[model samples]
Target: MQAVDQPERRATPTIRYFVRDLDAAVDFYRQLLGFEEELRPNPVFAMLYRGDLRLLLSVPGTYAGGHALPDGTLPSPGGWNRILLQVVDLDAAVEALRRAGVHFLDDRPSGVAVRQVLLEDPSGNPIELFEPATGYHERAR
Candidate 1:
């Protein structure tokens, strides 16, 4: 059998968040969420990465991804749907963020699976920080 050449591949998950202010969004992700800026092609678009997660920040009026529907409804930020980030110490993380003037929606324990705290980005996009409980594996089963 002859060997075949294969193209390189990578699996880095990405999510796009529509924001009103591109610079503010970049600062929030870079300083608070620990995402390093990957690229800023222009004023309208920027990319940030943390581990395997790539975040795309787009300004509604300038970026194509933030374009309105044919019905004339414009894209906007803020919704219950959110990005979940797993943390080792949920409480400590929450406290630190709170001290830095970040606002949290709530801080609660989700039974035995995980302890979660919800916060919003500058544009009001939700982000959940959770720490799995010690018995999380058992509860998951």
Candidate 2:
């Protein structure tokens, strides 16, 4: 067969979270979520990755994406929209984070498929940690 070419594609999706302090945000994600710092080109921006997730941390007023709008509305962190991370043990994770002085918005079990909790980064950006229900693996297969 003739050779075919395909465009390069990222294996993981990158989500950017606007932060007030880049260093603090980096510490929070790195220490709490186990995200490793990938690249930091400057003091105002950083890249973190864990598993297949890539998180871009940017300080407002420093980067284009974190810049204020034409209407003078500045993009800030903290919102209902959040990134969900799956874990094998929700209780253990929650306990560990709690012991580390992390703040949680809420922790509750869903109907029959998931147990999840919402926590915040130093920038107040929300992150959801979830554990699948008992039969989830069997059902998924």
Candidate 3:
């Protein structure tokens, strides 16, 4: 969709989570979910990476992230929407996370084309783990 004269561009996928404790959030992502810490520039924020995914962790009501909106609404964590990570073995991953005392919304894997379990980070933001099933489908590269 671009002109040949223009350079190609790549955008990193990013998700910002408003957490209660930035340090704990950083630890949870880095230690539990296999994310590597990319930046911890301030007390209120951190950046983590897993593959092409860039995660931004920020404390609520402190940094540039969680300030109140013009309607007096403050951003908070714990929503239904979540980031889904595909895994080879969902049960093994869930078992390991269970051993580490991770909070899971549901550990019973269930899906049509992909089995999945939902778990929460330290701040209660949902993260889904899925394993492809017999009819699993993905776009061609």
Q: What are the models' TM-scores?
A: 0.86, 0.87, 0.88
Q: After superposition, how far is residue 104 of candidate 3 from its true place, in Å?
A: 0.8
Specify the highest-TM-score model's number: 3
lDDT digits (tens) for residues 63-129 of candidate 3: 5488888898889999998888888889899999999999899999998888999999999999999
Q: Residue pairs in steric clash, candidate 3?
A: none
Where does candidate 3 stray beyond 4 Å?
Answer: 1-8, 138-141
Decreasing lDDT order of the candidates: 3, 2, 1
lDDT (10s digit) by residue, model 2, range 1-141: 749764587458889999998988999889888899999988888989999899998888766378878898888999898999988888999999989888888866454678888898888999999988888779989
lDDT of 1 by residue, 1-141 (tens): 749764578657889899989999999989888899999989989999988999899988664488878898878899898889988888888888989888788866465577888899989999999888888688678
lDDT of 2 at 9: 75
Question: What are the Cα lDDT values of the candidates?
Answer: 0.85, 0.86, 0.87
Best by lDDT: 3
The lowest-lDDT stretch of 10 consecutive residues in candidate 2 is 2-11
RMSD of each: 5.0, 4.3, 3.8
